[model samples]
Target: MNVVSKIEAAAPAAAVEAPAERMRRVVAVAVEHGDAVDREGRFPAETVEALKRERLLSVAIPAEYGGEGLGTAAVADLIAQLAQACGSSAMIYAMHQIKTSSFVMHGTGSEWHRAYMRRIAAEQLLMASATTEAGIGGNLRNSICAIEVEDGRFRLTKEAIVISYGNYADAILATARRAPDAASSDQIMVVIPNDANRTIDRTVVWDTLGMRGTCSDGFHLEAVGNAAQIFPKPFSEIAAQSMLASSHIYWAATWFGIAADAFNRAQAFVKAAARKQTDGTLPPGALRLAEAAAKLQEMKGHLMAAIHRFDAAQVDAARGDDAALSSIGFAAEINALKVAASEKAGEVVRIALLVNGILGYKNGTPFSVGRHLRDTASAPVMISNDRILSNTATLLLMSRFDTSLGG
Candidate 1:
């Protein structure tokens, strides 16, 4: 089935509004304010409000928790559509879903997380993540800070390197060492609500070239909550099982959305140029447009394939296949998807810019692709393609590549 068919099939039986329809309304708001959000370097408040109104935040949560229980394919499709409207908004939405997936897939064993999922559905609360830390560099698995437990409560102070939409999030999912004396890699995921008991002090400004509206600034996050807020599983298992795959898939979808928008603008410019030409002559950029289209198609194919693999793994995992989600081949494939999508997204946007020529280079024009290009440029460096490649290389060394067509 096609992506749209899969999304429709995955929708809840009792859903009042289809996921696609709700996204259309949200996309309208995102497109309307995308420029202003980018120019001001602030959060996409209006678009987020639309999301809350549409209740798309809880679409990934299970139906048991008042959610739609949509699969990864459906969520990725929605994210890509939103990215075509606004990169920052789409990214914010993707991050929220990524964090929510963790709770839905891993936190159901605990009552606090189960109740929080219900609250997310009822209240449409936004979630942010704080996995990157100061001293650890870009290694998310290691953390210097640890959660301190006392009297059935826990407290943690993390010098987060970057927290996207941190201030606006209703709750932040942070990673830290399991105990004061535990190894740096012995980490746990904690859900810290942005309430009176928590404090966030901005330590770094988030003025960047692209995706400025994300407001991904560094902060000193100090929060206290019940011990039950922490997930029972170690951070490593959670990352291997859900977090890594979800992050790569959703993020690639977001990049594909941005690049797709650029391709659209380029196609429009080509058609407009064709209209002005005499005889049956094609525009100079027509060839380039075809090339960019191919690259975009390839990017989409990679993303869709990854989504299918992950969805299948989820099914197998549910069927009691313990290694379905954590196999060496699966991990390498997902990591490779992120690397390919990120790099190809930049290529597609850059080619689109060339197709639009000077019009696309400018900031304000009917065929301008500056925003798309800039936004896509951040994809490669978001998690640092180099870092992912290194990790994937290690994984590949231990596993043989599957060359079979149906493997």
Candidate 2:
């Protein structure tokens, strides 16, 4: 069976109601400014503003720290909603959430962290993640960037390839290698002020097939003060569990938004064309459009169900690396959903092209489908499907070996 069919056959029960109105506002802002952002390669300032105004940025912050303290499932729902509207905005938004989560989880008690997070909670400040480097890539275990202890303080410098919202963000959450012998993982997560000797090369621009508004540009690092840095946990421990799980969940949720929006658009297109247009006195390509729409709905259900499972695991069980690894199952499920949605994006665009003909490709048509299609298509590659699958296989093999040895 196809991914959609598998999802339909074993759909998990629903858990919570997503903030539909809030999500709709995000979509409206994205769609409204999408073209301008695309035309000028500008950041989606309005969309980001809408999210901040809605206080959606604080979805993950704990209540004790002046945040809503919602769980992963809710945050995922919001991200998926945002993705459906604008992939670039969603990506930017996703990075912001990652930065925010990193701060809250790691920098909670520090005065600098606490002050920064307070501004974030109040929507007065924005944070972006800058972990993915150019030559070194995003390997958490191995990175050339270093933080050396100097005169009882850490001196840090690192290159970051694409820091989303780099231009507008108040802070950046970065990951680098510690003094080699200092830790087992060699990784360290730190927050840096956006203007901390961080010079933007401005050589790279996000001129891809989709998500044109993310403004995820490349940058060069310079010697900067380490006074603003905070380590929530040791690099090895975060790598072994929390960081990976958090990233996967947030990213997976955002892609679902892209899929969901494509599906909704396809559904509306099909319904309208079915009633208004007919080739040879019958609706042409109506059945294909219907199929695509159905698949999208099925995909949404699967995505939500997978999230529910993860939420349950978090709420009712012992939590640790083992518990966090359980999220990989959800990760796989998300991968399948993304695949389904991405493929469906092409199909829906085709259907839209067929149904609306030249109008679909016209200047102001809402059917400007190229953007999300490109963005979603690029997502799997950026995330490294092969790596995730390989890791899953390794984990499975290790579990089986442990079982056989009666451990």
The prediction achieving the highest lDDT against the true structure is 1
Off by over 4 Å in 2: 1-23, 109-112, 180-185, 195-203, 226-228, 277-282, 316-358, 361-363, 400-407
**Location of the lowest summed lDDT over 10 successive residues in candidate 2:** 8-17
Score each candidate by Cα lDDT: 0.91, 0.63
C-alpha TM-score for every candidate: 0.95, 0.79
lDDT of 2 at 112: 74
Candidate 1 residue lDDT tens string, 269-378: 99999999998989889999999999999998888888888988988988878497999999999999999999999999999889888999998787788988788889
Off by over 4 Å in 1: 1-15
How many pairs of residues collide in model 1? 0
